[model samples]
Target: MQFENTREFARQLDKEDKLSRYRHEFIFPKVNGKEVIYFVGNSLGLQPRSAKKYVDEIMKDWAELAVEGHFYADKPWWDYHERFSEKLAKVVGANPSEVTVMNTLTVNLHLLMVSFYRPSGKRYKIICEEKAFPSDQYMINSQVRFHGYDPEDAIVEIKRREGENNFRTEDILQKIQEVGEECALLLIGGVNYYTGQVFDMETITKAGHDVGAFVGWDLAHAAGNIELKLSEWNVDFAAWCSYKYMNSGPGNASGCFINKKYHNKKDIPRFEGWWGHNKERRFLMEPEFHPEPTADAWQISNAPILALAPYLASLEMFDEVGMPALIQKRNKIVAYLEYVLQEIDKDVESTFEIITPAEQEDRGTQLSVFLHGEGRELFNYLMEQGVITDWREPNVIRLAPAPFYCSFEDMYEFGQILKKGILSKQKV
Candidate 1:
């Protein structure tokens, strides 16, 4: 795809896209009354226009039906949490029972830790990336300390080679081999928030198991952006937020998974609540905590139905497109984006670097561009001009071409914005 300028290229690509109609379903923000090129879905996805109506139903249920709403209504408020369960399962490649919607991301991460991270004398250390999402760092550190151990000693962080911006597969595998005997849990991001790098989950999961450790992942960035099979991967457990690529509203509900392998384990220690009690006799309120046999068994309380509505609406669209097909679309779109970014980087020579992997399979929709000497200035200039990409700390700009809605031309335009933004500096 050759282009004279981003606008013309975008129009042509949109015309050829099978998913072009999806753009109309979303509410894009206006910059000076014009639609800005939105490429930051990796940070916060655009809201669906239908979200208002979806949210209104919950408001109406609470207002009109009041107490009776729980057992009444078309979808039934009593089973309201189940409304999006099946669709949520389809999005993450899980059995209906293997997935459940509940809690915020960090809260769910803690709950999963309660059930999965059982530390002991010889095998009590935790393994995670050095630059994990800050919340994850806090979550793991707290867990390590909660188990009566010092975080600095109990927690181990894997870093890239001294001068490298990303971790090599062999580096991660070697770290696991080196620490496997002492590791109690291997917790990692499904996709690194800062680098936009996707790690090999299957191999990591296998290695963790080889040394008798529980393996879990935080899919905050990867869940809706990438294709995954948590159950097939034998991942002991995982959790993710839906607001980013899922297009759920800000602070929306999160979803989690437990491989069927642990579903029947009644002895698995947990921080159980009423909602997680056996569904059939939950109303009986017996003293014994007889848990549900599925992932629903992990739920600590009823979900925020209103907060989950937009996620339901978004997951329905994913169901229509299917994850595999969406991933295929994502790979091609980002490759086009990457190709253009490289072209521009070549034009500027050493001014910037693509910190994300060059290979398609090693990332989702996101690309992290590190500016050489003045990243924040370049990023702010792009933002002022209405090129909507995200800026991480120090010197990196993160752009995600969400496959369900982001277009090839949108990716093209972001590159052009960066290129033009840099060239404008020469005239200044």
Candidate 2:
């Protein structure tokens, strides 16, 4: 991983990358028809070219087969959804039966909340990070209110110590123990959207289970960004969107996970739909619900086969390169990014701080930079220079070097652009 300089280092690294072949699989963003250095895969991944072909297959199925496509056509649209469960499960570290594709992120969170976040009168509280994504916060708030409880009282928000930007594991474990008596469920983002902080799910799950509480995770930022073992971690339930690191396209169908332990539990109240019924009896149209004994029981609607097409294509790429192999490259790329940020003139580097946890295990693909004094104009300047990243108002600009498409040369170019932008802003 040693480098003589940025550009030469890029060609050398690309030479050694096992996943290097994946670069051509995607279509990068264009600015005035030129390729822009896209680092916002943490927000929206670059689309794969095969996505169109995947869609075309479904289109042909619809057009040629017409009404017969549902059950009698090749691959049978009626069971097409089943084809991907095994592939997706490989990515998220779950069994095929323990996963299902369905509604979008926030909607799936709401559906999972219906079955997992059962709050009783005395022990009714959700412990979540204070700076969680707005959609997750809103979902938790509305769910609390739906249960006839005040969000202010029912949602326990965790944060770093005063004047701190991130929460430490010790603090999180201590807080869970302190409030374990009242907490009904633990619902946290697998990775913080703004800070790029990756929570230790195994420890968090164990802490909640120790307190006799259910645990769930919002994997909007974690899935495809980091290696996850949801099944081995024994997480009770989880939901994630695929548009970001998953590269499924904007607002693509989301995937959800429910621990197999909950599948046979008769007491866990689920908001059931026909799609979640046992496949053996799905077409029976029986009045009584016969729920599947796996995460598929969480499904409330049919899979969006058209919307999920990109998932299949993108996942196929992961399968070819392997998830761990891609992550290995990201670890080096992200560390290089952090190094470049720190190498800027001391005065300039001090002007903004990277809020992402420094440890390799504590973050995924994103680096959330908090502007120390200059405010957001620096982010705008970078954008104007075609270094397309996402700015979360107030002060944070999230930079993500997606392994599938981002290059070391892109990161190097970004550093020069960033330094130039900061220098220009400082002169003002």
**Highest lDDT scorer:** 2
Task: Score candidate 1 by lDDT.
Answer: 0.84
| Ten contiguous residues minimizing lDDT sum, candidate 1 | 1-10
lDDT at position 70, candidate 1? 74
lDDT per residue (tens digit) for residues 1-428 in model 1: 45443567667777877787888889888887877778888778899888888888888888899877777865566567776667777777778888888998999999999988888878999999997999999999999989999998988899989888888878888888999789999999989999899989988999899989999999989988887878788888989999999999898888898888888797888889989888888899799998888888888887777888788888878888778877877877777777787778877634667899888788888888888866577878887877888888788888888877777777776777778878777567
Give the per-residue Cα lDDT of candidate 1 at 291. Answer: 87
| Local accuracy of candidate 2 as per-residue lDDT tens digits, 1-428 | 55534677767777877777778889876776768888899888999999999888889989998878788766677677777788788888998888888889999889888887888768898999887888888889999999999998999988889888788888888889988778899999999888888999899899999998899999988888889899999999898998999899998988898888888777888888988888899989899988888777777777777887888888888777767988899898898888777766463744668888889999889998877776677777877777898888778888999999888878778888888887777676
Task: State residue 296's C-alpha deviation in candidate 1, in Å.
Answer: 0.8
Residue-level error in angstroms, candidate 1, position 189: 0.4
